[model samples]
Target: MTIGGHLEELYGLPAFTFPGPGETPRELPEPDAVAWRITADSYDAEEQWTEAFARFCSAVDTTRVRALAVGAWEDAYDRGPGDIIEALVTARDRLPGLRSLFLGDMHSEECEISWINQTDVTPLLSAYPALEEFGVRGGQGLRFPALRHDALRTLIVETGGLPVEVVRGIGASELPALENLDLWLGTSWYGADSEAADLEPVLSGARLPRLRYLALRNSEIQDEIAAAVASAPVVARLEVLDLSMGTLGDDGAAALLGGQPLTHLRKLDLHHNYLSEPLLRRLRETLGSAGVELDLDRDDADWDEDDDGTVHRYVAVGE
Candidate 1:
Protein backbone atom coordinates (compact mmCIF):
# COMPACT_ATOMS: atom_id res chain seq x y z
CA MET A 1 0.00 0.00 0.00
CA THR A 2 1.07 3.58 -0.56
CA ILE A 3 2.04 5.94 2.25
CA GLY A 4 -1.11 7.88 1.50
CA GLY A 5 -3.28 4.79 1.84
CA HIS A 6 -1.58 3.86 5.09
CA LEU A 7 -1.96 7.36 6.45
CA GLU A 8 -5.61 7.42 5.46
CA GLU A 9 -6.17 4.16 7.29
CA LEU A 10 -4.26 5.40 10.31
CA TYR A 11 -6.19 8.65 10.42
CA GLY A 12 -9.49 7.03 9.49
CA LEU A 13 -10.05 9.37 6.57
CA PRO A 14 -13.10 8.70 4.41
CA ALA A 15 -10.99 7.62 1.45
CA PHE A 16 -12.03 5.57 -1.56
CA THR A 17 -9.42 2.92 -2.24
CA PHE A 18 -8.75 1.84 -5.81
CA PRO A 19 -8.42 -1.66 -7.22
CA GLY A 20 -5.30 -3.15 -8.75
CA PRO A 21 -4.96 -3.54 -12.50
CA GLY A 22 -7.43 -6.07 -13.99
CA GLU A 23 -9.35 -6.20 -10.69
CA THR A 24 -13.01 -5.28 -10.73
CA PRO A 25 -13.64 -1.73 -9.69
CA ARG A 26 -15.49 -1.03 -6.44
CA GLU A 27 -19.24 -0.58 -6.66
CA LEU A 28 -20.05 3.07 -5.99
CA PRO A 29 -23.67 4.15 -5.76
CA GLU A 30 -25.15 7.55 -5.38
CA PRO A 31 -23.68 9.91 -2.75
CA ASP A 32 -20.72 7.52 -2.40
CA ALA A 33 -17.62 7.97 -4.62
CA VAL A 34 -15.20 6.03 -6.80
CA ALA A 35 -11.56 6.87 -7.60
CA TRP A 36 -10.24 6.48 -11.15
CA ARG A 37 -6.51 5.76 -11.09
CA ILE A 38 -5.13 6.66 -14.52
CA THR A 39 -1.81 5.32 -15.74
CA ALA A 40 -0.11 5.61 -19.12
CA ASP A 41 1.10 2.07 -18.65
CA SER A 42 -2.44 0.81 -19.03
CA TYR A 43 -2.49 1.43 -22.76
CA ASP A 44 -1.61 -1.41 -25.12
CA ALA A 45 1.32 -1.03 -27.60
CA GLU A 46 -0.77 -1.11 -30.79
CA GLU A 47 -3.64 0.96 -29.32
CA GLN A 48 -3.98 4.63 -30.14
CA TRP A 49 -4.30 6.85 -27.07
CA THR A 50 -6.01 9.78 -28.74
CA GLU A 51 -9.08 8.54 -26.93
CA ALA A 52 -7.17 7.09 -23.99
CA PHE A 53 -8.31 9.46 -21.22
CA ALA A 54 -11.66 9.86 -22.92
CA ARG A 55 -12.40 6.17 -22.41
CA PHE A 56 -12.06 6.53 -18.65
CA CYS A 57 -14.23 9.62 -18.72
CA SER A 58 -16.93 7.82 -20.69
CA ALA A 59 -16.70 4.63 -18.62
CA VAL A 60 -17.38 6.33 -15.33
CA ASP A 61 -20.53 8.31 -14.82
CA THR A 62 -18.75 11.56 -14.14
CA THR A 63 -21.70 12.76 -12.11
CA ARG A 64 -21.10 9.82 -9.77
CA VAL A 65 -17.32 10.28 -9.81
CA ARG A 66 -17.04 12.40 -6.74
CA ALA A 67 -13.44 11.50 -5.93
CA LEU A 68 -11.07 11.37 -8.94
CA ALA A 69 -7.54 10.23 -8.22
CA VAL A 70 -4.81 10.78 -10.82
CA GLY A 71 -1.94 8.29 -10.81
CA ALA A 72 1.16 8.15 -13.06
CA TRP A 73 -0.23 10.71 -15.46
CA GLU A 74 3.31 11.99 -15.71
CA ASP A 75 4.06 9.08 -18.00
CA ALA A 76 1.36 10.19 -20.39
CA TYR A 77 2.66 11.38 -23.76
CA ASP A 78 3.59 15.03 -24.12
CA ARG A 79 3.43 15.31 -20.33
CA GLY A 80 2.11 18.71 -19.29
CA PRO A 81 -0.80 20.30 -17.44
CA GLY A 82 -3.07 20.11 -20.45
CA ASP A 83 -3.25 16.34 -20.84
CA ILE A 84 -5.65 15.11 -18.18
CA ILE A 85 -6.61 18.51 -16.88
CA GLU A 86 -7.92 19.58 -20.25
CA ALA A 87 -9.92 16.39 -20.53
CA LEU A 88 -11.53 17.05 -17.16
CA VAL A 89 -12.22 20.71 -17.84
CA THR A 90 -13.87 19.91 -21.15
CA ALA A 91 -16.00 17.33 -19.38
CA ARG A 92 -16.95 19.63 -16.54
CA ASP A 93 -20.54 19.80 -17.67
CA ARG A 94 -20.81 16.04 -17.27
CA LEU A 95 -19.09 16.17 -13.86
CA PRO A 96 -21.20 18.76 -12.14
CA GLY A 97 -21.47 16.66 -8.98
CA LEU A 98 -17.79 15.83 -8.61
CA ARG A 99 -16.54 17.00 -5.22
CA SER A 100 -13.15 15.56 -4.28
CA LEU A 101 -9.99 15.26 -6.40
CA PHE A 102 -6.58 13.75 -5.65
CA LEU A 103 -3.68 14.44 -7.99
CA GLY A 104 -0.36 12.57 -8.21
CA ASP A 105 -1.64 9.47 -6.43
CA MET A 106 1.34 7.31 -7.44
CA HIS A 107 3.69 5.63 -5.00
CA SER A 108 7.46 5.42 -5.44
CA GLU A 109 7.10 2.58 -7.90
CA GLU A 110 5.29 4.75 -10.44
CA CYS A 111 6.97 8.03 -9.58
CA GLU A 112 8.69 9.38 -6.52
CA ILE A 113 6.53 11.86 -4.67
CA SER A 114 9.07 14.66 -5.14
CA TRP A 115 9.45 14.04 -8.88
CA ILE A 116 5.78 14.32 -9.80
CA ASN A 117 5.59 17.42 -11.93
CA GLN A 118 2.62 19.70 -11.35
CA THR A 119 1.45 23.01 -12.71
CA ASP A 120 -0.85 25.77 -11.58
CA VAL A 121 -4.03 24.12 -10.28
CA THR A 122 -6.04 27.27 -9.77
CA PRO A 123 -7.81 26.46 -13.02
CA LEU A 124 -9.44 23.45 -11.31
CA LEU A 125 -11.31 25.66 -8.85
CA SER A 126 -12.69 27.64 -11.75
CA ALA A 127 -13.67 24.50 -13.58
CA TYR A 128 -15.27 22.73 -10.61
CA PRO A 129 -16.90 25.19 -8.32
CA ALA A 130 -18.62 22.32 -6.49
CA LEU A 131 -15.32 20.75 -5.49
CA GLU A 132 -15.19 20.36 -1.72
CA GLU A 133 -11.88 18.54 -1.30
CA PHE A 134 -8.68 18.82 -3.38
CA GLY A 135 -5.30 17.22 -2.73
CA VAL A 136 -2.05 17.29 -4.69
CA ARG A 137 0.94 15.15 -3.69
CA GLY A 138 3.88 16.71 -5.51
CA GLY A 139 5.19 20.24 -5.13
CA GLN A 140 7.57 20.62 -8.06
CA GLY A 141 6.40 23.62 -10.06
CA LEU A 142 3.07 23.51 -8.26
CA ARG A 143 1.22 26.78 -8.14
CA PHE A 144 -2.16 27.72 -6.67
CA PRO A 145 -3.05 31.38 -6.75
CA ALA A 146 -5.52 32.82 -4.26
CA LEU A 147 -9.03 32.17 -5.43
CA ARG A 148 -12.50 32.06 -3.92
CA HIS A 149 -14.24 28.71 -3.86
CA ASP A 150 -17.21 28.80 -1.52
CA ALA A 151 -17.82 25.04 -1.29
CA LEU A 152 -14.21 23.99 -0.82
CA ARG A 153 -14.04 22.37 2.60
CA THR A 154 -10.59 20.78 2.44
CA LEU A 155 -7.35 21.78 0.69
CA ILE A 156 -4.27 19.55 1.00
CA VAL A 157 -0.97 20.39 -0.69
CA GLU A 158 1.68 17.74 -0.07
CA THR A 159 5.12 18.60 -1.34
CA GLY A 160 8.70 17.75 -0.57
CA GLY A 161 9.22 21.50 -0.58
CA LEU A 162 6.21 23.76 -0.73
CA PRO A 163 7.07 27.17 -2.14
CA VAL A 164 6.43 30.34 -0.18
CA GLU A 165 4.48 31.76 -3.09
CA VAL A 166 2.03 28.91 -2.76
CA VAL A 167 1.82 29.53 0.97
CA ARG A 168 1.05 33.19 0.34
CA GLY A 169 -1.56 32.23 -2.20
CA ILE A 170 -3.30 29.95 0.32
CA GLY A 171 -3.26 32.70 2.91
CA ALA A 172 -4.76 35.07 0.41
CA SER A 173 -7.42 32.60 -0.72
CA GLU A 174 -11.03 33.12 0.23
CA LEU A 175 -12.20 29.67 1.23
CA PRO A 176 -15.18 30.62 3.38
CA ALA A 177 -16.08 27.03 4.22
CA LEU A 178 -12.60 25.54 4.48
CA GLU A 179 -12.62 23.00 7.32
CA ASN A 180 -9.34 21.14 6.90
CA LEU A 181 -5.99 22.53 5.69
CA ASP A 182 -2.81 20.47 5.43
CA LEU A 183 0.40 21.92 4.01
CA TRP A 184 3.63 19.95 3.95
CA LEU A 185 6.28 22.60 4.40
CA GLY A 186 9.16 20.66 2.90
CA THR A 187 12.90 21.41 2.90
CA SER A 188 14.37 24.75 1.82
CA TRP A 189 16.29 23.08 -1.02
CA TYR A 190 12.96 22.20 -2.64
CA GLY A 191 11.73 25.82 -2.56
CA ALA A 192 10.02 25.77 0.85
CA ASP A 193 10.46 29.39 1.85
CA SER A 194 7.38 29.83 4.01
CA GLU A 195 8.11 30.90 7.56
CA ALA A 196 5.84 31.49 10.54
CA ALA A 197 4.98 34.89 9.11
CA ASP A 198 3.56 33.33 5.98
CA LEU A 199 1.35 31.14 8.15
CA GLU A 200 0.15 33.98 10.40
CA PRO A 201 -3.21 34.27 8.67
CA VAL A 202 -4.01 30.63 9.30
CA LEU A 203 -2.84 30.74 12.90
CA SER A 204 -4.85 33.89 13.62
CA GLY A 205 -8.06 31.85 14.04
CA ALA A 206 -9.96 34.45 12.06
CA ARG A 207 -9.26 33.76 8.36
CA LEU A 208 -11.05 30.45 8.12
CA PRO A 209 -13.60 30.46 10.90
CA ARG A 210 -14.79 26.94 10.16
CA LEU A 211 -11.35 25.31 10.20
CA ARG A 212 -11.18 22.28 12.53
CA TYR A 213 -8.11 20.41 11.24
CA LEU A 214 -4.73 21.98 10.55
CA ALA A 215 -1.55 20.13 9.61
CA LEU A 216 1.62 22.20 9.21
CA ARG A 217 3.71 19.13 8.72
CA ASN A 218 6.77 17.64 6.97
CA SER A 219 8.91 20.63 7.65
CA GLU A 220 12.57 21.19 8.28
CA ILE A 221 11.54 23.93 10.65
CA GLN A 222 8.96 21.96 12.60
CA ASP A 223 10.35 23.20 15.87
CA GLU A 224 9.82 26.80 14.85
CA ILE A 225 6.38 25.93 13.53
CA ALA A 226 5.56 24.13 16.77
CA ALA A 227 6.51 27.17 18.79
CA ALA A 228 4.24 29.29 16.65
CA VAL A 229 1.38 26.77 16.67
CA ALA A 230 1.61 26.45 20.45
CA SER A 231 0.51 30.05 20.75
CA ALA A 232 -1.67 30.30 17.67
CA PRO A 233 -5.19 31.37 18.54
CA VAL A 234 -6.57 28.81 16.08
CA VAL A 235 -5.44 25.89 18.24
CA ALA A 236 -8.30 26.47 20.67
CA ARG A 237 -10.86 25.85 17.96
CA LEU A 238 -9.07 23.12 16.00
CA GLU A 239 -10.10 19.50 16.52
CA VAL A 240 -6.87 18.00 15.13
CA LEU A 241 -3.42 19.54 14.94
CA ASP A 242 -0.69 17.58 13.14
CA LEU A 243 2.99 18.48 13.38
CA SER A 244 4.19 15.11 12.34
CA MET A 245 6.87 13.90 9.86
CA GLY A 246 9.26 16.67 10.73
CA THR A 247 12.15 17.71 12.92
CA LEU A 248 10.11 18.65 15.98
CA GLY A 249 12.46 18.17 18.92
CA ASP A 250 12.46 18.59 22.67
CA ASP A 251 12.04 22.35 22.47
CA GLY A 252 9.08 22.12 20.13
CA ALA A 253 7.45 19.34 22.13
CA ALA A 254 8.01 21.32 25.32
CA ALA A 255 6.22 24.27 23.82
CA LEU A 256 3.22 22.12 22.95
CA LEU A 257 3.26 20.32 26.32
CA GLY A 258 3.64 23.36 28.56
CA GLY A 259 1.46 25.56 26.41
CA GLN A 260 -1.90 25.29 24.63
CA PRO A 261 -5.22 24.22 26.17
CA LEU A 262 -5.42 21.02 24.12
CA THR A 263 -7.93 19.23 26.34
CA HIS A 264 -10.63 19.75 23.73
CA LEU A 265 -8.67 18.55 20.70
CA ARG A 266 -9.49 15.14 19.23
CA LYS A 267 -6.00 14.16 18.01
CA LEU A 268 -2.40 15.27 17.95
CA ASP A 269 -0.03 13.59 15.48
CA LEU A 270 3.70 13.96 16.22
CA HIS A 271 4.95 10.86 14.47
CA HIS A 272 8.54 10.67 13.08
CA ASN A 273 10.07 13.39 15.20
CA TYR A 274 12.99 14.03 17.51
CA LEU A 275 11.11 13.93 20.81
CA SER A 276 12.94 12.26 23.67
CA GLU A 277 11.53 9.12 25.34
CA PRO A 278 10.71 10.87 28.61
CA LEU A 279 8.93 13.68 26.84
CA LEU A 280 6.98 11.25 24.69
CA ARG A 281 5.86 9.33 27.78
CA ARG A 282 4.76 12.50 29.52
CA LEU A 283 2.96 13.71 26.40
CA ARG A 284 1.10 10.41 26.06
CA GLU A 285 -0.06 10.47 29.66
CA THR A 286 -1.12 14.08 29.45
CA LEU A 287 -3.00 13.92 26.16
CA GLY A 288 -4.43 10.47 26.93
CA SER A 289 -5.92 11.75 30.16
CA ALA A 290 -7.38 14.64 28.19
CA GLY A 291 -8.97 12.23 25.67
CA VAL A 292 -6.79 13.37 22.81
CA GLU A 293 -5.31 10.66 20.59
CA LEU A 294 -1.56 11.13 20.45
CA ASP A 295 0.63 9.59 17.75
CA LEU A 296 4.31 9.51 18.63
CA ASP A 297 4.86 6.30 16.78
CA ARG A 298 8.26 6.86 15.11
CA ASP A 299 11.22 8.44 16.77
CA ASP A 300 13.94 10.25 14.81
CA ALA A 301 17.22 8.58 13.94
CA ASP A 302 20.07 9.36 16.28
CA TRP A 303 20.88 13.04 15.98
CA ASP A 304 23.72 14.05 13.64
CA GLU A 305 26.65 15.54 15.49
CA ASP A 306 29.84 17.23 14.40
CA ASP A 307 33.22 17.03 16.07
CA ASP A 308 32.16 19.77 18.48
CA GLY A 309 28.97 17.86 19.38
CA THR A 310 26.59 20.24 17.60
CA VAL A 311 23.45 18.24 16.82
CA HIS A 312 21.28 18.45 13.73
CA ARG A 313 17.93 17.13 12.55
CA TYR A 314 16.19 16.67 9.21
CA VAL A 315 12.65 17.01 7.97
CA ALA A 316 11.02 13.66 7.29
CA VAL A 317 10.30 12.95 3.59
CA GLY A 318 12.11 16.07 2.37
CA GLU A 319 14.89 14.19 0.69
Candidate 2:
Protein backbone atom coordinates (compact mmCIF):
# COMPACT_ATOMS: atom_id res chain seq x y z
CA MET A 1 0.00 0.00 0.00
CA THR A 2 1.15 3.53 -0.76
CA ILE A 3 1.21 6.51 1.61
CA GLY A 4 -2.02 7.90 0.13
CA GLY A 5 -3.89 4.69 0.74
CA HIS A 6 -2.50 4.52 4.27
CA LEU A 7 -3.71 8.06 4.98
CA GLU A 8 -7.11 7.22 3.57
CA GLU A 9 -7.28 4.22 5.84
CA LEU A 10 -6.03 6.19 8.84
CA TYR A 11 -8.09 9.38 8.50
CA GLY A 12 -11.35 10.27 6.78
CA LEU A 13 -12.27 13.43 4.87
CA PRO A 14 -12.51 16.30 7.31
CA ALA A 15 -16.02 17.51 8.08
CA PHE A 16 -17.06 20.97 7.02
CA THR A 17 -19.85 23.36 7.96
CA PHE A 18 -21.37 26.48 6.42
CA PRO A 19 -23.04 29.44 8.05
CA GLY A 20 -26.79 29.19 8.49
CA PRO A 21 -29.39 31.66 9.75
CA GLY A 22 -30.17 31.27 13.47
CA GLU A 23 -27.66 28.40 13.71
CA THR A 24 -24.66 28.41 16.04
CA PRO A 25 -21.48 26.68 14.94
CA ARG A 26 -19.69 24.61 17.50
CA GLU A 27 -16.31 24.86 15.86
CA LEU A 28 -14.53 26.74 13.10
CA PRO A 29 -11.23 26.34 11.25
CA GLU A 30 -9.44 29.31 12.70
CA PRO A 31 -6.12 30.60 11.47
CA ASP A 32 -4.26 28.62 14.10
CA ALA A 33 -5.96 25.41 12.97
CA VAL A 34 -3.31 24.94 10.30
CA ALA A 35 -1.22 22.79 12.63
CA TRP A 36 -1.36 19.00 12.22
CA ARG A 37 -0.09 16.23 14.48
CA ILE A 38 0.80 12.63 13.65
CA THR A 39 1.90 9.85 16.04
CA ALA A 40 3.18 6.47 14.79
CA ASP A 41 4.56 3.65 16.89
CA SER A 42 6.03 0.31 15.80
CA TYR A 43 3.65 -1.43 13.37
CA ASP A 44 1.04 -4.03 14.28
CA ALA A 45 1.99 -7.35 15.85
CA GLU A 46 1.37 -9.47 12.70
CA GLU A 47 3.12 -7.11 10.27
CA GLN A 48 6.81 -6.28 9.90
CA TRP A 49 7.48 -2.78 11.20
CA THR A 50 9.60 -1.62 8.27
CA GLU A 51 7.14 -2.86 5.66
CA ALA A 52 4.27 -1.22 7.46
CA PHE A 53 6.17 2.04 7.62
CA ALA A 54 7.05 1.83 3.94
CA ARG A 55 3.42 1.23 3.10
CA PHE A 56 2.41 4.13 5.31
CA CYS A 57 4.86 6.40 3.54
CA SER A 58 3.78 5.26 0.12
CA ALA A 59 0.12 5.94 0.88
CA VAL A 60 0.56 9.52 2.00
CA ASP A 61 0.46 12.35 -0.57
CA THR A 62 3.58 14.22 0.41
CA THR A 63 2.70 17.18 -1.81
CA ARG A 64 -0.09 18.15 0.58
CA VAL A 65 1.41 17.04 3.87
CA ARG A 66 3.23 20.12 5.11
CA ALA A 67 4.05 19.18 8.71
CA LEU A 68 4.99 15.69 9.94
CA ALA A 69 5.86 14.34 13.36
CA VAL A 70 7.59 10.97 13.76
CA GLY A 71 7.45 9.58 17.27
CA ALA A 72 8.34 6.25 18.84
CA TRP A 73 6.13 4.80 21.51
CA GLU A 74 7.27 2.87 24.59
CA ASP A 75 7.26 -0.30 22.46
CA ALA A 76 9.93 1.22 20.21
CA TYR A 77 12.51 0.10 22.77
CA ASP A 78 11.56 -3.52 22.12
CA ARG A 79 12.27 -3.29 18.38
CA GLY A 80 15.71 -3.52 16.82
CA PRO A 81 17.52 -0.22 16.27
CA GLY A 82 18.03 -0.91 12.56
CA ASP A 83 14.31 -1.40 12.00
CA ILE A 84 13.55 1.88 13.79
CA ILE A 85 16.00 3.75 11.61
CA GLU A 86 14.61 2.16 8.45
CA ALA A 87 11.06 3.22 9.27
CA LEU A 88 12.14 6.78 9.96
CA VAL A 89 14.27 6.92 6.81
CA THR A 90 11.31 5.73 4.74
CA ALA A 91 9.03 8.53 5.99
CA ARG A 92 11.67 11.18 5.52
CA ASP A 93 12.52 9.97 2.02
CA ARG A 94 8.91 9.95 0.89
CA LEU A 95 7.72 13.18 2.49
CA PRO A 96 9.03 15.68 -0.01
CA GLY A 97 6.70 18.52 0.94
CA LEU A 98 7.24 18.28 4.68
CA ARG A 99 8.18 21.66 6.18
CA SER A 100 8.47 20.48 9.78
CA LEU A 101 9.80 17.19 11.12
CA PHE A 102 9.46 16.57 14.84
CA LEU A 103 11.36 13.57 16.24
CA GLY A 104 10.07 13.15 19.77
CA ASP A 105 10.89 10.80 22.63
CA MET A 106 13.38 8.49 20.93
CA HIS A 107 14.65 6.15 23.67
CA SER A 108 17.94 4.38 23.05
CA GLU A 109 20.08 3.12 25.91
CA GLU A 110 23.07 2.28 23.68
CA CYS A 111 23.32 5.63 21.85
CA GLU A 112 22.58 3.97 18.51
CA ILE A 113 20.14 6.66 17.35
CA SER A 114 20.78 9.80 19.38
CA TRP A 115 24.47 9.75 20.42
CA ILE A 116 27.08 11.68 18.43
CA ASN A 117 29.33 8.61 18.42
CA GLN A 118 26.77 6.40 16.71
CA THR A 119 26.92 8.29 13.36
CA ASP A 120 24.47 5.83 11.78
CA VAL A 121 21.59 8.32 11.90
CA THR A 122 23.31 10.75 9.55
CA PRO A 123 21.66 9.25 6.49
CA LEU A 124 18.21 9.74 7.98
CA LEU A 125 18.56 13.52 7.73
CA SER A 126 19.15 13.28 3.97
CA ALA A 127 15.47 12.60 3.29
CA TYR A 128 14.41 16.01 4.56
CA PRO A 129 15.58 18.14 1.64
CA ALA A 130 12.73 20.63 1.97
CA LEU A 131 12.44 20.56 5.75
CA GLU A 132 12.45 24.07 7.19
CA GLU A 133 11.78 23.23 10.84
CA PHE A 134 13.24 20.22 12.70
CA GLY A 135 12.98 19.36 16.39
CA VAL A 136 14.41 16.49 18.44
CA ARG A 137 13.43 16.02 22.05
CA GLY A 138 14.31 13.67 24.95
CA GLY A 139 17.11 11.94 23.09
CA GLN A 140 20.60 11.21 24.44
CA GLY A 141 23.74 12.93 23.13
CA LEU A 142 22.10 14.37 20.06
CA ARG A 143 24.36 14.89 17.02
CA PHE A 144 24.02 16.30 13.48
CA PRO A 145 25.14 15.07 10.08
CA ALA A 146 28.09 16.86 8.51
CA LEU A 147 26.10 17.37 5.29
CA ARG A 148 24.55 20.81 5.10
CA HIS A 149 21.14 21.52 3.59
CA ASP A 150 20.17 24.98 2.41
CA ALA A 151 16.43 24.48 2.90
CA LEU A 152 16.51 24.08 6.65
CA ARG A 153 15.53 27.33 8.41
CA THR A 154 14.87 26.28 12.03
CA LEU A 155 16.57 23.52 14.05
CA ILE A 156 15.87 22.56 17.64
CA VAL A 157 17.95 19.92 19.39
CA GLU A 158 17.19 19.08 23.04
CA THR A 159 18.86 16.07 24.49
CA GLY A 160 20.65 14.68 27.56
CA GLY A 161 24.36 13.84 27.97
CA LEU A 162 25.39 15.74 24.81
CA PRO A 163 28.77 17.43 25.09
CA VAL A 164 28.68 21.19 24.61
CA GLU A 165 31.65 20.92 22.21
CA VAL A 166 29.83 18.43 20.01
CA VAL A 167 26.79 20.68 20.00
CA ARG A 168 28.86 23.72 19.05
CA GLY A 169 30.79 21.83 16.38
CA ILE A 170 27.58 20.58 14.81
CA GLY A 171 26.02 24.04 14.90
CA ALA A 172 29.10 25.60 13.33
CA SER A 173 29.37 23.17 10.41
CA GLU A 174 25.81 22.23 9.61
CA LEU A 175 22.75 24.50 9.26
CA PRO A 176 24.25 27.26 7.17
CA ALA A 177 20.81 28.54 6.11
CA LEU A 178 19.42 28.22 9.61
CA GLU A 179 17.42 31.19 10.95
CA ASN A 180 16.19 29.80 14.27
CA LEU A 181 18.39 27.67 16.54
CA ASP A 182 17.21 26.25 19.85
CA LEU A 183 19.89 24.27 21.68
CA TRP A 184 19.53 22.74 25.15
CA LEU A 185 22.70 21.53 26.80
CA GLY A 186 21.74 18.91 29.34
CA THR A 187 24.91 17.54 30.92
CA SER A 188 27.18 20.58 30.54
CA TRP A 189 26.91 22.69 33.68
CA TYR A 190 28.66 25.93 34.54
CA GLY A 191 30.77 24.40 37.31
CA ALA A 192 32.23 21.85 34.87
CA ASP A 193 35.51 23.30 33.56
CA SER A 194 35.86 20.99 30.55
CA GLU A 195 32.42 21.61 29.08
CA ALA A 196 32.59 25.36 29.68
CA ALA A 197 35.86 25.67 27.77
CA ASP A 198 34.66 23.42 24.94
CA LEU A 199 31.90 25.82 23.87
CA GLU A 200 34.09 28.96 23.77
CA PRO A 201 35.47 28.50 20.23
CA VAL A 202 32.07 28.09 18.59
CA LEU A 203 30.64 31.04 20.47
CA SER A 204 33.42 33.28 19.17
CA GLY A 205 33.07 32.10 15.56
CA ALA A 206 30.95 33.82 12.89
CA ARG A 207 29.04 30.66 12.02
CA LEU A 208 25.34 31.51 12.06
CA PRO A 209 25.00 34.43 9.66
CA ARG A 210 21.28 34.05 8.93
CA LEU A 211 20.34 33.12 12.48
CA ARG A 212 17.62 35.48 13.74
CA TYR A 213 16.19 33.45 16.62
CA LEU A 214 18.45 31.73 19.20
CA ALA A 215 17.56 29.80 22.32
CA LEU A 216 20.15 28.38 24.71
CA ARG A 217 18.26 26.49 27.35
CA ASN A 218 19.74 24.45 30.20
CA SER A 219 23.28 25.18 29.02
CA GLU A 220 26.37 26.10 30.99
CA ILE A 221 27.14 29.44 29.27
CA GLN A 222 29.33 31.96 31.07
CA ASP A 223 29.18 35.75 31.04
CA GLU A 224 31.95 36.06 28.44
CA ILE A 225 30.14 33.89 25.90
CA ALA A 226 26.89 35.70 26.61
CA ALA A 227 28.67 39.01 26.02
CA ALA A 228 30.12 37.67 22.81
CA VAL A 229 26.70 36.54 21.63
CA ALA A 230 25.21 39.92 22.45
CA SER A 231 27.98 41.73 20.64
CA ALA A 232 27.94 39.54 17.52
CA PRO A 233 26.96 41.60 14.47
CA VAL A 234 24.71 38.78 13.31
CA VAL A 235 22.69 39.26 16.50
CA ALA A 236 21.61 42.67 15.26
CA ARG A 237 19.25 40.90 12.87
CA LEU A 238 17.78 38.63 15.53
CA GLU A 239 14.06 38.91 16.19
CA VAL A 240 13.87 36.43 19.05
CA LEU A 241 16.35 35.47 21.80
CA ASP A 242 16.12 32.84 24.52
CA LEU A 243 18.82 32.14 27.13
CA SER A 244 16.82 30.28 29.72
CA MET A 245 17.97 27.65 32.24
CA GLY A 246 21.62 28.69 32.11
CA THR A 247 23.86 29.73 35.04
CA LEU A 248 23.47 33.35 33.94
CA GLY A 249 22.65 35.37 37.05
CA ASP A 250 21.51 38.97 37.23
CA ASP A 251 24.88 40.22 36.08
CA GLY A 252 25.04 37.98 33.03
CA ALA A 253 21.43 38.68 32.18
CA ALA A 254 21.95 42.40 32.56
CA ALA A 255 24.99 42.35 30.31
CA LEU A 256 23.17 40.35 27.60
CA LEU A 257 19.88 42.23 27.71
CA GLY A 258 21.60 45.56 28.12
CA GLY A 259 23.82 45.36 25.05
CA GLN A 260 21.25 43.99 22.58
CA PRO A 261 21.65 46.06 19.41
CA LEU A 262 18.77 44.34 17.65
CA THR A 263 15.79 46.64 17.77
CA HIS A 264 13.93 44.19 15.52
CA LEU A 265 13.73 41.59 18.28
CA ARG A 266 10.06 40.89 18.94
CA LYS A 267 10.38 38.32 21.69
CA LEU A 268 12.81 37.23 24.42
CA ASP A 269 12.50 34.13 26.60
CA LEU A 270 14.41 34.11 29.92
CA HIS A 271 12.68 31.44 31.86
CA HIS A 272 13.71 29.26 34.84
CA ASN A 273 17.11 30.92 35.10
CA TYR A 274 18.77 33.02 37.78
CA LEU A 275 16.88 36.26 37.00
CA SER A 276 15.45 38.33 39.83
CA GLU A 277 12.52 40.79 39.72
CA PRO A 278 14.80 43.79 39.46
CA LEU A 279 16.65 42.26 36.56
CA LEU A 280 13.39 41.19 34.95
CA ARG A 281 12.08 44.73 35.42
CA ARG A 282 15.19 46.10 33.78
CA LEU A 283 14.78 43.72 30.82
CA ARG A 284 11.14 44.67 30.45
CA GLU A 285 12.05 48.35 30.58
CA THR A 286 14.75 47.94 27.97
CA LEU A 287 12.48 46.08 25.59
CA GLY A 288 9.54 48.41 26.19
CA SER A 289 11.62 51.53 25.83
CA ALA A 290 12.98 50.25 22.52
CA GLY A 291 9.51 49.15 21.30
CA VAL A 292 10.77 45.55 21.24
CA GLU A 293 8.46 42.79 22.46
CA LEU A 294 9.33 40.56 25.43
CA ASP A 295 8.31 37.18 26.70
CA LEU A 296 9.75 36.65 30.17
CA ASP A 297 8.89 33.30 31.72
CA ARG A 298 7.87 34.28 35.21
CA ASP A 299 7.20 32.16 38.29
CA ASP A 300 3.98 34.03 38.91
CA ALA A 301 0.77 32.15 38.10
CA ASP A 302 -0.49 34.97 35.90
CA TRP A 303 2.35 34.30 33.48
CA ASP A 304 0.87 30.98 32.36
CA GLU A 305 -2.45 32.66 31.66
CA ASP A 306 -0.79 35.08 29.29
CA ASP A 307 1.05 32.19 27.66
CA ASP A 308 -2.13 30.28 26.84
CA GLY A 309 -4.04 33.31 25.61
CA THR A 310 -2.65 33.51 22.07
CA VAL A 311 -0.45 31.82 19.57
CA HIS A 312 2.59 33.83 18.54
CA ARG A 313 1.81 36.31 21.29
CA TYR A 314 5.44 37.33 21.25
CA VAL A 315 6.90 36.50 17.85
CA ALA A 316 10.48 35.80 18.89
CA VAL A 317 9.82 33.67 21.97
CA GLY A 318 8.27 30.29 22.99
CA GLU A 319 8.34 26.97 21.17
Q: For this target, which candidate reaches the highest TM-score against the unseen true structure?
A: 1
Query: Which residue pairs of candidate 1 clash?
Result: none
* Tens-digit lDDT string for candidate 1 (1-319): 1244312311123444443345576654333333544445422322222244566555566666666666555353224445667777787898787787776666665555666678888888889998998888777878888888899999999888898989988988888899999999988877788897889888886769899999999898898899999889999999999999888889999988888778899999998888888988889888878799988877454358899988877777763
Candidate 2 at residue 261, lDDT?
A: 65
lDDT of 2 by residue, 60-179 (tens): 454566654444433343433355556666656455555766554333431223231212344555766777777665433234535677778877765444444446556556566888
lDDT for 88 (candidate 1): 71
Task: Tell me model 2's lDDT, rounded to 2 decimals.
Answer: 0.51
The TM-scores of all predictions, comma-separated, are 0.85, 0.65
What overall lDDT, based on C-alpha atoms, would model 1 receive against the true structure? 0.75
Each model's total of backbone clashes: 0, 7
Q: Candidate 1's error at 91, in angstroms?
A: 1.2
Please report, as a residue range, the 10-residue window in candidate 2 with the lowest summed lDDT: 1-10
